[model samples]
Target: MGPGETGLNYMQQLNQIVYPGIGKTTNDNDCFVKSRSIFFNGTTDFEQSIEEEMHRYQLIWENGYFLKTLKEISHILNGENYDWELDIDSKTKNTRSNYIKDAIITKFSKAPNFQNLLKEAYNKDLRNAITHTQYNLIQGGVVLTNIKGDNHQPFYGITFEKWEEIYSKAWFLLRYIFSGLKDIMELFMFHLRKKQSQVESPFSYQMVKNGSKHMHTILKEGTGGLFINEIALTISYISIFEI
Candidate 1:
């Protein structure tokens, strides 16, 4: 559910329980609930400006919560202890053991079908540029100033089109992880209801090579269900009705 829908449901439940006889003021209560729910729904703009997209992307990247969440999800998928820590060198272990970028690189590099997706979605150069405030907006592109190759090039420029592509990949990756978490939770509940000691997922992850791009696809065991594909990412969920 979206934020607004979830909030509205909560308010309805709260009213039914907390104020069972508030029907005389139902209109007032509902109007307040609906109005406040819109705030949780956030902006209605479907097509945001480039600056706005960059601002949102920078916020997610800088906060780094998604990176940690992704790692935790990977741990769950691998049937590992959730608290398992990635091994680090002594220096890093003593200082910044869970550094976001380093942890992401280490964890996904070893993940079976996720290595290429990481490369596609997580651009170290773009990340450095955004985090360090070393990028500039140009006429039709962005110039990244925090990048240096073996040739020691001072700056790198990415066209607006390229920027959109990269941003889309990152956005889709975020959505995929979110969807996967919800799906996993539902699957866990199903497992408990079925009283199964162990359950094998009907879904499997596959890396499909599409010319120059690698697509990460989550496929179910059967056909005739819904499938949503977003660029290089695909996430599958079992409908509650089906469960």
Candidate 2:
């Protein structure tokens, strides 16, 4: 198949695997559970997807194996074998992960501020209030509560409505990162296409261009003054490419 056809096919597969209608349960409780599942599953799954795509595209771009190279470099820097799978976890406070950290350090360790900047940004306060809130997992779903202090006083609790807000933020974050990565991938592919006239690249030059353009368009359009818009933008920029 041609580049465009292959690109569309890959996009379809991506939508199926990553964009499963995870939060579409009709029941309110099921909705919350599904929402949480996306985050938890995402934390465990998205990195590998990104890495696999990156490597696939890199080979297409004639850049060799980017993920493998990064892994080797990370291993060298850390003086130990590096596992990309280890980085995938929802509870990981450090967003960049040790593997990513070692890779960055390996590449730009001598650079003036890359390490410091990365270190600072890696531990960002992506900590949503929902993550901070306490929750009890029942058979059906989870009940969210705002427990405060050592005394564990229940502050403002979350039922369906409040939980929806949190769920929306989580979903927004996930989409933001996904779209942002698409943008970066598109840009990479665009450059690669120019460098190598081959259309076999999985990077999809046009898709990344379109993705970045769309992200900018959405930001320009604005979200009608929702606080979540800020979070969406922040996560999009931060997660896909280093801010």
Candidate 3:
């Protein structure tokens, strides 16, 4: 991760796919809900500005985590030379990393839906709109504008609904990759056991399957439901006070 890799070019290719609370406890599962609360509550001359700033910061942090995990997954897929005298002769060297090219997201773009989502959900153009301040909060949605064409004729505008759609799609794609990384880790542990001639493994494939399935359900469904629940809670609280 270089200092300026947060640039739009890098963000859309892989950085935009992030799972909000994938690793939190049940009692701590309020991050997305709380983030939505920012939209429901409060008003100030600087409120929109503040919200946008937070969005940028959060996106940056999310990419930081996303890229880091991707790298580790690359490592697992691309095993390293342990030079373990204990290791089997066939295990003297590893090549997945070489093939993966350091697990950069673009390397895996040959897959079917991947390139499409990367381009549509978190493309370079859209990232520039958010990162470069060429946007507006209009009608309760973020409006992204591009004025690049001659006479600014072929300009582009991305509305808030589209952004939300991108967010949802990005969530599923990113989490699917993360699930792969987790599965790889479990496989690593199993390999270590087999290398030791141990017939039993500490890993549970069923547990991993269940976890992965639950993640799919949540990212695909829970994102919106959490916001709706939060909005309702906020409304109920307000109504109680008013009544």
Candidate 4:
């Protein structure tokens, strides 16, 4: 049964015992006794509540980290440059890691320290971890402890968690990039089609040979359509294919 349902059952039992004459059926007395003992146990019910809350707190913290990273990257992408540093205070030393920064930077931008891309990837991973981890925790999954070293830690698998974070970041960043890229490509194709329509022989070698026309079309018709179109063109030409 669900936690609320279980809690209700316990309350029912407590009621029967406290007011014996009110609902003193044999079944009711039995249920009341059983549920009262189960609910009062410090380990089972109380510990479960604490675990759920902790998992939720962790999820929130991770999401916060992701949002912060995205904002930082957005600032960098806006042409403001800054040093990308991964800070880990002693309190979070065990849980926090800097490897995420390297992976994000490598995946998103040509420059080794492309701050925007790095931030975006970081945010993406954070969101993913929070989402997936919460899902696992809600399903009654046990949090395994690290008994290897001096630190007696309780957490899930490190590699799996890290990988989940990394891939999630990559997936989200790539998705964001691709969406912009697709819009630009569509705009570019539109221009090409418009130019071809205006020409005398749209399929002729001369029409195909007009490089200046293509450039002019992009500049005039494709440049100012929408932010998505502009971003798409900028990323496609500058980042991906290098036009």
Candidate 5:
């Protein structure tokens, strides 16, 4: 559900226990017991935001994979067309890896990374540690420990505000990709159809010599919305990657 709806649901459940004559609770004591019961429903205890925290974690990796997939598709569509700024006499052999990096820098104006998302949700050093190692559940929240770092320092806990920022970014990025992928699909289909129309036999001579006249019809739907919220939300999530 959306954030507003989710907040409403949370309040409704809380009120169901807090308000009198709702469910099996009719007083403060009953309310407290019902709330605790729900907290431990089918389990020893239920921690809040754990599911959302995990979702944010998975999205960080998945977002990186998403960007990689976009580069691959661009390569398939346009081939290795990266514009290198090296001197003409420079003999650096061009490779797919170099081409992908160049293409992303040229098109997206940045290197592909998920580091910002992870760092937004957690302390940067703690994020690096958790990414490499494991985290444990604690009373208030998850504790990320590094034997080398935390042994000399204190553990870092992912903050609620940062988690919200990460989650906001995840939704923003997914929608951004959704809009872009749809536009690309339309462009690809137009090219495919144009190619098919050019294949003429005796039964079907060149009735449509040029596809330029139909270009508007083919790409009309691709003038999609570049929503402002997409950028605003995404900037908060990946601000670190701007460098």
Candidate 6:
């Protein structure tokens, strides 16, 4: 299937996974959950739908795997393997790279075409407007009031059509990264299974899936359980120990 189709399928499957308090607020006594919060829905209101779409795009742009994948790819390209995070700048060393734009322009300069894709996907001005709450909803689109043009003069915001284009590019980049990582993970798992077959081990892993796998803190325990709270899934495991 095409990438779009594959992405759609993946999203559909992801949406199907049931979580407690999903589409609802979790409190002692009150909550409401709606899938529309996560995805743009069949709302009749055009402006509202556009607003929701913009918010969704902004959310992903800030917290998505796209940036993380970029850092990991940069590390591999630089041929430095460490258990720790990367220090892109030694002068002011940080685990995270502060020079994200440099990562695209300078680090990945060898691949001009891919660089273009990254550049197209990332719009610092637009993100700034969204992040800093410097925009307003117009008849057809929101105006980034602070964003200026080549002459360094403030211009009107992008059209709804333009915003849609930007959002699509960003979404495509996300799916592309996800697909690549999935392949790598599958290959790694295959190798892991192969290695396991060649070893005789006393250790046995027991996975108990109560629901969707989430990492919860195993605070008061001899054994540890990883809870992936972001996905709201619960998977508990017991490791066989010779006790």
Which candidate leads in lDDT? Answer: 1
The reply for model 6, stretches above 4 Å from the true place, is: 1-44, 64-66, 86-98, 148-154, 195-243
Q: Give TM per candidate.
A: 0.49, 0.29, 0.42, 0.27, 0.37, 0.53
Candidate 2: where are CA atoms >4 Å away?
1-17, 25-156, 197-243
Q: Give the Cα error of residue 150 in candidate 5, in Å.
A: 6.2
Quote the positional error of residue 179 for candidate 4 in Å: 2.0
lDDT of candidate 2 over 142-173, digit per residue (tens): 34454343455444333444433534443443
The CA root-mean-square deviation of candidate 6, after full C-alpha superposition on the true structure, stands at: 16.1
Task: Judge candidate 4 against the unseen true structure and give its global Cα lDDT, from 0 to 1.
Answer: 0.38
Ten contiguous residues with the weakest lDDT in model 1 = 232-241
Question: Per-model C-alpha lDDT, please?
Answer: 0.48, 0.36, 0.40, 0.38, 0.38, 0.47
Report the C-alpha displacement of residue 46, candidate 6, in angstroms.
1.4
Q: Write the per-residue lDDT of candidate 6 for residues 185-230, one digit (tens) a residue.
A: 5665575455444543224233335442322322221233332221
Residues 54-171 of candidate 1: C-alpha lDDT, one tens digit per residue: 6545544443335545555455444453432323223234433245456554565446456566566667677667767788665446788776545765668887667767777666
lDDT of 3 by residue, 1-243 (tens): 122432344446343324233222235444334443354333643344435433643363245445444433323333421111211112214532232233344533434254355445454555556566775554445545655555755555554446556655555556665465455456654644444343222222221332332111111122222212212222322221121
The parts of candidate 4 lying over 4 Å away from their true place are 1-149, 152-174, 198-243
Task: Estimate, for each residue in 25-133, the C-alpha lDDT of model 4 and write its tens digit.
Answer: 2334243224434433336653454334333333323332333333334434445432233232222354443434443343345444444545544443334445454
Show the colliding residue pairs in model 2.
186-208
Instruction: Between candidates 1 and 4, name the one with more favorable lDDT.
Output: 1
| TM-score: model 5 vs. ground truth | 0.37
Write out the backbone clash pairs for model 4. Answer: 13-32, 73-116, 125-169
Across 1-243, the per-residue lDDT of candidate 5 in tens digits comes to 022332343444333322322112133534332443343322432333444335444433323334343443333333332121222112213433243235433444343354343234333343344455566544434456653344655666654334445555544454455456555556655754654454432121122323411111111123332222222222233322344
Misplaced by over 4 Å in model 1 are 1-48, 76-79, 84-98, 110-112, 148-154, 196-243
Candidate 5 Cα deviation (angstroms), residue 168: 3.4
